[model samples]
Target: MPAPLLSLTWTDHVTGRQGFLVVDRLVRGVCSGGLRMRPGCTLDEVTGLARGMTMKEALHYDPSARYVPLGGAKGGIDCDPRSPEAYGVLVRYLRAMRPYVEHYWTTGEDLGLNQDLVDKAAREAGLVSTIQAVHPLLEDETEARARLADAFAVRVDGLGLDELVGGCGVAEAVLAALDRAGHAHAGARVAVQGLGTMGGATARFLARAGLTVVAVADVRGTIANPAGLDVEALLAARDAHGGVDRAALRPGDRELPGEAWLSTEAEILVPAAVSYAIDEVNQQRITARWIAEAANMPVLPEAENLLAARGVTVLPDVVVNSGTNAWWWWTLFGDIGADPDEAFAHIRRSMRALVERTLGRAAADGTTPRAAAHALVADRLPEIADRFGWYATPRKDAP
Candidate 1:
């Protein structure tokens, strides 16, 4: 069952503004979550996220797992930033939330929001960066996502790969897996879905690493090249918005149904799209020897089990998709604040270590990568919890 709701409150100010924060779960002193701005946001989701943050903190960071109290909390302003009068309403909402702005509920980008916009709201509310005016006790989601995306973009792009950071990391992991299993990247056929930051990154990375990116897709459409798509040409022709312009495409590449990209004949398939994108219904279409998840929960538990039964080696999401966020924290909270280059290096190191170790453990036990990761977390959480006094320590009997 989902965790129980730990705390909930709603506030209606004299200014006719509705503001509230839900500390759905609290482990210690830390709470982490996203700030959302959209319509019809209810208190339930915020509370749920708050709880998730606590658990996420508990799982992700062993050091803070005890003292951090990293509860998950989310704030939502039931307003659309796209609307003409959205900024004014957001300002009003922020003003009303001044009490929680700088400290209690550190806001970050979620649906219908971005860091720039979050900063706008922060500015109006007189909240500075954690180190600027006041050291923030909690981190915001926008910064986290930006940090991840930034790390992904800089390293992937600088390395001259078309893959987004998401893709590159997965590409690296896939290569690592293959090498361990005695398969090689050169002349490998790869199919990628989503073509978003993560997807594009993966495709580009694979292509450069000597994999034939035979198929790629986006929400708009798909293109297939059985003889290996010219990723560089396609990338060059891609529009500013990140979609390949078909009008500029060469004849070898032809458009296919978006879903068709997921089923193409390739040695590896990277799903960098939404969760549950691949279910039992479409799992049969999977042709890749390996399935790599570069999106959060892209593979359902059932689907994962099914893939495991089929002997299709799988690399779980957390192993591949955490590079960006890792660097973000290292930069913001580490004793040595990171510059851009150092940040990317930090992320790459974490990704390499996590993926390599998880893969090694999984291989030895003949277990799924996801299972190995959970085991890793499970092994670490208790020590953290103990150190933080989440449970009582036993007293020694006097001699």
Candidate 2:
């Protein structure tokens, strides 16, 4: 495993809030990742997530890729978002670490943090944000302007960026996987585990794309219908109840244990919740033909290996769910002169191509897609390192 380039921990004297920032790699001169604030957030979790960011950046980078002068890093604060002191704590935290944050790392929202809060904190700390700096420029085109306007409005309301694009990306990847497996999406069944932003968006997109979302799960429990559930109604109910409300179930929908979502017998299973939700113990119980990771690191290595051995097509998170990062890359480094619609169209094309290439490479090499992606990055890293002076010269007297 590659060690992080730098790790820094901080504590707020007033609120007794503590957190850490881990920069796993520096591809260029800068590093970027999300800032997650949760009660159970830990240094180890942040470190692992930082490393995952590095892998994500590596997998996304190619010689012909656009200029993305960023590495991978992650930050977390051990405080619950529901706490009354959340805003004050975040401001102090950012004020204390402004220099490091401004010079070395750029952060957006993760699990418990939202972009609006981050922006507020950044402003309070006298720190300029890359997101804020570039978001305004995307308003030059009609469609892009509308999208940015909606995203900005949503952010102001403390909601995350529109997950429609991300969901569309997931749906596209599912279709690609099904096509590769010689299956059709028309009437294909998909079970989405989690009704949060990503999972809910994915479920909606899949349904819109003509696939049947046979089952859906949230913190409350799983509600399934073999004949397809009304995704729009389900989302509305979830929004009202903070989860899948049992009272909102339709006549044909049946509520089952949350774990039942994992074994719901679908062509595609999307684990879009917490990390490591599918592990060794329950890997054998998975009944999906394809496992698309809509959440970060949803499958542990052991579980992934078991699934791969069993001939399940596991679409890695880094590739399938890279829409957010890709959007940021476009905003930060894409052709500013181009129309916003054109820029987004380019991203869609590139993402689809990446999925196709990774799947093709995996098939040709007889390896899992995750392994194939890592191998591609591994093969390219030395060259990047050499160019960026990341390599150390060997000493003549060294043993």
Best candidate, TM-score: 2
What candidate 1 gets wrong by more than 4 Å, as runs, is 1-28, 33-101, 104-114, 117-167, 232-242, 335-341, 388-399
Most accurate candidate by lDDT: 2
lDDT of 2 at 397: 26
Please provide, for model 1 over 255-314, each residue's C-alpha lDDT reduced to its tens digit, 9 standing for 90 to 100.
Answer: 999889778988888887555678877887887888887755567778778878988877
How many steric overlaps are in each model, in order?
16, 0
TM-score of every prediction relative to native: 0.71, 0.84
Decoy 1 TM-score against native:
0.71
Instruction: Return model 1's CA RMSD, one decimal.
Output: 7.2
lDDT of each: 0.61, 0.74
Q: Candidate 2 lDDT, tens digit per residue, 1-399?
A: 778888888888988789888988765456677888878777888898887777666666666654443567888899987799988888887887777675567677776665667888888888766243223223243554455444444431233444455665677788778777788778999999887767887888789889999999887788999999998888777752137767778899998888898899798999887777899999888878899998788899999888888878899987887776666555445432234445446556766777888898898998999988877767756677776546222322236
Candidate 2, residue 287: Cα displacement in angstroms equals 0.7
